[model samples]
Target: MRIFDPHIHMTSRTTDDYAAMAAHGVRALVEPAFWLGQPRTSVGSFVDYFDSLVGWEPFRASQFGIRHHCTIALNPKEANDPRCREVLDILPRYLAKDGVVAVGEVGYDSMTPEEDDVFAAQLELAERFELPVLVHTPHRDKAKGTTRTLEVVRESGLDPSMVVVDHLNELTVGEVADSGCWRGFSIYPDTKMDPDRMVAILTEYGTERVLVNSAADWGKSDPLRTYATGQAMLAAGFSADDVDQVLWRNPVAFYGQSGRLELEGADADEGATFEGNSILRGARAS
Candidate 1:
């Protein structure tokens, strides 16, 4: 039952989250750069965020026996701010860091021109670095946004194989699949697809080129929604292997291209601590 959560925001989660995910068989995770719960006011903020993704975060996950990797990008929601361009300029540096698996969480929110600029720029960064791109389709008006996201990928001249269009639902899953890129679903508690609906999508698409994530972040989303989706698949009579492939194999195959994932031996301790620091420091051992 080894699993990989291909999209999570560990920077917004707790150390207990890492332990819980590992206890539930999440052997690895990939956290994409995202808009902070509060807006970032400076480029230094983005730098610290990127450092946490590759540095303290991975060290923390190891304590829970979960391998950690990440996607680095400017989130679409933040792209509109004129200040955001400064952060975008620095993405190439972060994308090249160890444990950065892709350029992502990048795509449209309001379909604004700024979103396009950031999205397109990151796509070029992905290409420039020969990395994969993880896209965050708009939460609202997903059907329109998903198509537009595909179009942007086409216009950027990036390989479709190096793109993953995430946060999809039934409305856009077909188009996303037909576009010859990986399709990702975020099984959230309220805003995104529920477990029952996620199971139906897998049944409809047969899981060949699809992926599922929690998209867990500062929102009221469950960090283990992907695991819950697997339970739903079991209740629906899907074979264990079928469930495993969609939830784990596809994401690993996708992110492993970045050359960052690592495994923890069974004997690994996964529990260590640092002095004078809390989860706020994000550097606690294991």
Candidate 2:
């Protein structure tokens, strides 16, 4: 039962977390650049953040034998900061870098004007790079946020197949799926959708182009959510195939489309290295 976590925030996680996930069958993971728990004060911070996404984090995952990939973006929550826009401008250079599978986790947050501007710009960048996008709907005013996200995606003229609208609840699931894009549900602790509810949604909708992620980060989140969600499905009488499609196949189909994520020999060293005197510091590449 090889699993692929299509979305996670490994930068804020520890090596122990990766070991547990890999032990439970998380063979690969795709992380998205998101709002750090604390606000970053400068463009340099973002550059360092991006560096970690492609460099340090992947190395950390390899220590546990998991393949790591990422989605590059300016998180919608930070889009409103004028200073953050400076970091957004340079995102293009990194989007095409190795290990970035999608331009994502970008969409509405509070539905502000800055979110709109940044979202629109990133969509254009996705178009230019011919890359897929992973959109994050607002936690509040979600129905409206999902609707606007659909509209903006359509306006961007990106093929609907290339878009994944994430963090859907009951209200937005139908609309998001009906919009001809991939739909994602985050099984979080007390705030986002529950595992039992996620099972119910699968029973009702019969999972097609849908994805599930922990959306775990520097907050109250369960690191083993993808594994737990699979267990819930099994307890509900879902076949191994059913769980595989939802947690493994679906995400692999999505990320593999980018041709970035690759599987090395199980014995190959996938660790990452940092230059001496560099601001980056973490596990060294072996």
Candidate 3:
């Protein structure tokens, strides 16, 4: 089945992962800006990271025939840092970029007042830019975080259909469903919802606005979980169209709100150069 992973962190991944993802039928993906394991000290660090998200990463993914798009934001964890806060000013420039499909990974991390302020401000940015948003609910105290998230989303006055609250499980999906925002599940090998559990949610929810992703990053995450989820859905008697809706159509509908998804021409060009640097090393293979 064809797939579009709506949320993943490709900055921390290698080219091998890209090859594997393409081989497994992942044709497109959205990489939202997020906290790196190492704390970034200044806005400049974020600048470099954001540049790569819009530049190098897409080139790398294209080398594997995967159309890569990204969301730009000062992620929740870093919003608390005084130095990192300046990055928010620079965000408008990136948000105006071509491959930036949304403003995202923007929501509660610690749920600090700092987080609250930043999250709201970014929502305003999303509204002003007329782009969709990818909201990240806290890994801890998720139910509470998600509730607070929907409240702020409501307060922001952005259309519910324009937002996607991600990293959900059975406990939190219902509230997001009722709120009219899209539901996003990150199928992980451990910790978050697995493939089987995701299938059950689809069974109950019937796959209207649901988006399933690998959400893979630098951690112990699996990049092929989206493919795995599709396989599980088939095993559980889901039709091909059902898998297509969850894996492909759902994400396109959500991120397509940006009017910036470039799905065609994803074929790999090994000779491609981003800033005069190709993915190839020293010598050409003869």
The digit string of per-residue lDDT tens for model 1 on 141-222 reads 8888888989989888887878899988888988988888998888888887999998888888887878888988988988
Best by TM-score: 3
Runs in model 3 deviating more than 4 A are: 265-286
lDDT of 2 by residue, 76-113 (tens): 98888888888777998999898999998799999888
Return the candidate ranking by TM-score, descending.
3, 2, 1
Cα error of candidate 2 at position 171, Å: 1.0
Best by lDDT: 3
* Each model's total of backbone clashes: 3, 1, 0
The model with the greater lDDT, 1 or 2, is: 2
How high is the CA lDDT of each candidate model?
0.81, 0.83, 0.89
- TM-score, cand. 2 vs. native: 0.91
RMSD of each: 6.0, 7.0, 6.1
By lDDT, the better pick of 2 and 3 is 3
Compared with the true structure, the alpha-carbon lDDT of candidate 1 equals 0.81
TM-score of candidate 3 versus the correct structure, residues matched by position? 0.92
Query: In model 1, which regions exceed 4 Å deviation?
Result: 264-286
